[model samples]
Target: MKSKPSGTLSARHIVFFVIAAAAPLGFAVGSIPLAIGRGGIGTAAMFLVAGGFLALFAVGYVAMTRFVPNAGALFSYISAGLGRPLGIGVAFVAALAYALVSAGAVGPFSVFAEQMTQSLFGVTVPWPVWAIGGVVVMGILGQLNVELNMRVLGFFMIAEVTVLGVLGLAVTFQGGATGLSLAALSPSTIAQGQIGVVLLFVFAAFAGFEATALFREEAKHPVRTLRRATFGSIAVIALLQSFVAWSIVQAFGATVVDVANATPTEMFAIAARNYVGDWFANLITILVVCSWFASISAFHNATTRYLHALARDRVLPAVFARRSQRTNAPWVASLTHAIFTLVLIILCIVAGLDPYLDLFVLGSVPVAVSIPAMECLTAIAIISFFLKDRRGLSAWVTYVAPAISALALAVVVYLVLANMEFYTAQTGAINWILPGINLVVLGLGVSRALWMKYRSPRLYEGIGRYGLE
Candidate 1:
């Protein structure tokens, strides 16, 4: 067996990786318009609210590093606090969420890539071809050193941020169409929209930060790096997203809500073209593709790591835990993830689903369900862990903070459930059906854990035994 790679990732590497998973440009081009339409001027405030909740969650999350250190992320934390049975259940939930979202990106990536290819070089290729091409590229990258993937993501991350930053600054300096007002941040403006739906979008935007702890085993200084990366990623994403949203509001002035409602999908690109130039808008379009690629790579890394962690703990086939002798990458797990996503893409094509609408929307539903569920679980795990075993930690760090975070996440979950129709924009059975599928997945996970406990008690005992590596 090849030795596992260790101490190869810095805080910066982890930070960029998490941000890439969040896919700032993709959100800006895709989801932000929807957020603006629904939340109106209060979009920025919702982001801050989401950020605060995550920050509080991070307080206990990072503190867990002092005791539980494993790449299983919420799995390990839950097992430590809750128990191995529940931990195993969450492992499946996390895998399903990450895998669905990762695979979901291929659709958008292919759609945009095909469009850009035809527009730029006049070469007309089918969307599936571009998607398969991305699968090939991502698979190859997945088998390389973790640092190599980090560098690739870093470059793409910088490009995505730079383009948006330029557009944001341009709008800021020009004083927008509204001439710089704080109305967007006003209480009345925030109250005007459906805060529940807006909060769901806000929470979804911050989904990737939890991946920070997933890199614990590879981080140079696991404790410090995890803490810094988690907090930093949340802070940066919140501020950047809020600032960009505000810039758009300023650009559209009094008509911002109307424009967002009318052109939720094209608002950002239109804003870029209007404020910057056609050239910048073109650049933004290009970066949107790169943004998807970066996100795919980031999500690939995360999903593979989760598989590796499970396999390492004997929950999955040990072959998945195998590392490449040369690069020390989780080659088996990466390949498995790649093949899985490729299959999903093929299925979508066969079904004749719209990549942007059907694929992305349905794909995101699992993620929306899984992430908040995990957050709420993790927060409860934190409180439960500290309550049972203080381990010399402060009450605020372990109890108060996590309790507040849990309450916030509970609200998020309620909001998501209450507004599923608005959230998915799908009527009829699909909305309930998609979320129901998640529950079935969770049920299977829990059932598997209970079976393991009864039939293979010893194996179940090792569910979340961190520090094994």
Candidate 2:
């Protein structure tokens, strides 16, 4: 008989993996500026709010792990609570969401890498060349042992966080132009501008925390490890992002919003140059590249695992479930994801889309829509599962927490849709088109689930069940 992959991940390994997926440095440098501009000084509070909602979502999520320990995470949880058909549908959404986000990182990574190389060494490389190179490296890593990828991600994650930490400290101690204040955290400040718009970016930053549950099968102590990793990732990301946003406010003083609005893209880099030095600003640029690389690798792993779970259930081709005999890696699924990303990158090149602006914006739309929808559905699943079979679980742990999370996530979803124009900065058909595409993806998933139920009832029954062959 063939050996199955054994659990090797500890809490720390899972934590690093999810955090790397969050890509703190890249999000801060790339996305936070727009967040600050829209949310103003209160942007820090928005992160806290978003984190709180996610933490509540984790409460029931981790509780469900006791009953269902499938690597499919959201798929398994939703299926166990709702039904096999919904679970199968969720599996499709999860795979597509992660894949879209991962592919989105490619454009930014290539663009940043090209910019850094030219600025630092006077070498001008095309974005596609850099993108293809990154894909090759990520593909190689994704097809190896999970532990090996974790180790490499650990190095990049630490470096990315450390650089941000140093910059935060520098800004705090030196006290920007206003000399440090609680102004950003004030209720009035947070209510500034269109808060709904800020919520989109804040929620997007927390995209990878759900990945904790996805590693349940590989985690050493699935229950405790998943719980700790989930809560810890949310807490760390929330605190770190909040501090960094406040630091930027301090650096710019009362003019923080004006500056962010004026130079939305270069706001963070400019802050680094003003507070730290040219050398540190240059370092931030390089770390942005590393951060994107870490994010791509992290999401590639996530996408393959989701595909692996789907294949195992016969939802996808059996070939996707093939694992390496030596490393136990989901080699076929990994390769498929790599190739899928390359094809998209090639399409972007052929269409002559701007790497940072057009490709990144379009690629991010699906993930931004799908993730919150999945979270909301998962929360409902938790409530449903617990209500049907309490299994001695507390009401607060199962029902109350998830209910609150669902409500909060539903609001986030609404806000994301409401702010689609702001997100894409497009005025007409494109705005509706981006969201319309996501609805189609969701429709496809539901239709496939219904098809499976009628055509293959037995296979449908195994949708979210753990240990199914």
Candidate 3:
């Protein structure tokens, strides 16, 4: 028996997972204002430009879905095209990237959870209580069947998007601070003020899009479903980000940049109040908290599956491959990942780290760095895979598109590395140390793969091939 497919998932379900990971309302209220500050009035176009650039990467990515085994996307794709060693190496890096995202998210999730509670019921509970309690709930949820998890993610995703969409529409209908303007989308604004920085912030919003590929066995019509989910997530994220960004410009009208620069954090809260109502603003604030939790859940599910993929392939421990016969969820791996997440948050708390600056900012650095680096490698892998066997696919999908995407991603990798301190808002050993962790992890993975190649050749052959022995 192949023991394949607990096949109730679809492209729409995967789309829910991906968007939940991106956390549209959270990004809109939190990051977009800062993006506006750096990128200036042209922030709207920057979101679309980043999306278009990723679409180039997606062209080759989706094309190869038919060839690469769906055993955790990044590792399997790189391994199939490049080699088992690099694939194992990527598998480790992929795990590191996704696992750390929760590290960054949990701190803020706690803070907002506390805020939402106190706002609603005049109860000032401490953040640490919420922090540990939050992970506890997700840990239990992680062990359940994924459909249950996806439904929770879906409800939050819809609620946040609806709130943001209503705000945008309200701005359109009532006219904004200076009477809705086209200044945000003006073609002339494209080349203006630090466009590179705009691309940096916007691209980061699109980081978790690959969670879709990990669901292949569970997907109805795996290939087509993967393709649609892959492309569809990109389009929805880009449009939602761009539309709301442009609306913010309209909402504030004339002094948008001045206000964004002056008060980036509170700008969205203010917009929600003026355009809609104070109650709507409160709802948006509550949704921001939900948004961060949704992202944590989405990434938790992604990393658990990533761990299970590696375990079944013998890249890690066989113990992790244990699953629920009834729900088919990877129960053991899910618990393992949940435990890992809890320890990281607890460690940060014990060290007396500031959850916002030290925990959230520094914790997020690896995800911001490693994900782009992996994308570059995967794009290059696609080019290599196609060069050998075109398999009747067009040159564009096979090679041309990925080549351009790889080159573009190479620059993105450099830009992210160069600006680490600026965004992390830290100076000193912390900069190199953060990225250094990712490099060391990647190197260790490569070293392990080399050792496995000679010592355990059969298992090595199965790495990232869905345990093909």
RMSD, model 3, all Cα superposed? 2.1
Superposition error at 468 for model 1 (Å): 5.3
Candidate 3: where is the Cα deviation over 4 Å?
1-6, 467-469
lDDT of 1 by residue, 1-469 (tens): 1123359788899999988988899888887788888777899777877888899999999998767778889989998888877887888889888888888888888898888778677999999898889989999999999899999999998998888789889998999996998777776766888898788787877877998988888888888888899999999899889888888888899998899889886888788888989888778878899999889889999999999998987788889999999999999999999999888888888999888777787778878877988889999999998897688888999999999999888988888888888877778988778877777777777888888789888888887775754
What residue pairs are clashing in model 1?
Answer: none
Writing each residue's lDDT as its tens digit, candidate 2 over 42-113 gives 888888888988999999988887778688999888888888767777778789889988888998999999
Give the C-alpha miss distance for residue 109 in model 2, angstroms.
0.6
| RMSD in Å for all candidates | 2.6, 2.5, 2.1
Q: Give the whole-model CA lDDT for all candidates, comma-separated.
A: 0.86, 0.87, 0.84
Candidate 1: list runs displaced more than 4 Å.
1-6
Better of 2 and 3 by lDDT: 2
Q: What's the true lDDT of residue 287 in model 3? A: 91
Clash count for each candidate, listed in order shown: 0, 0, 0
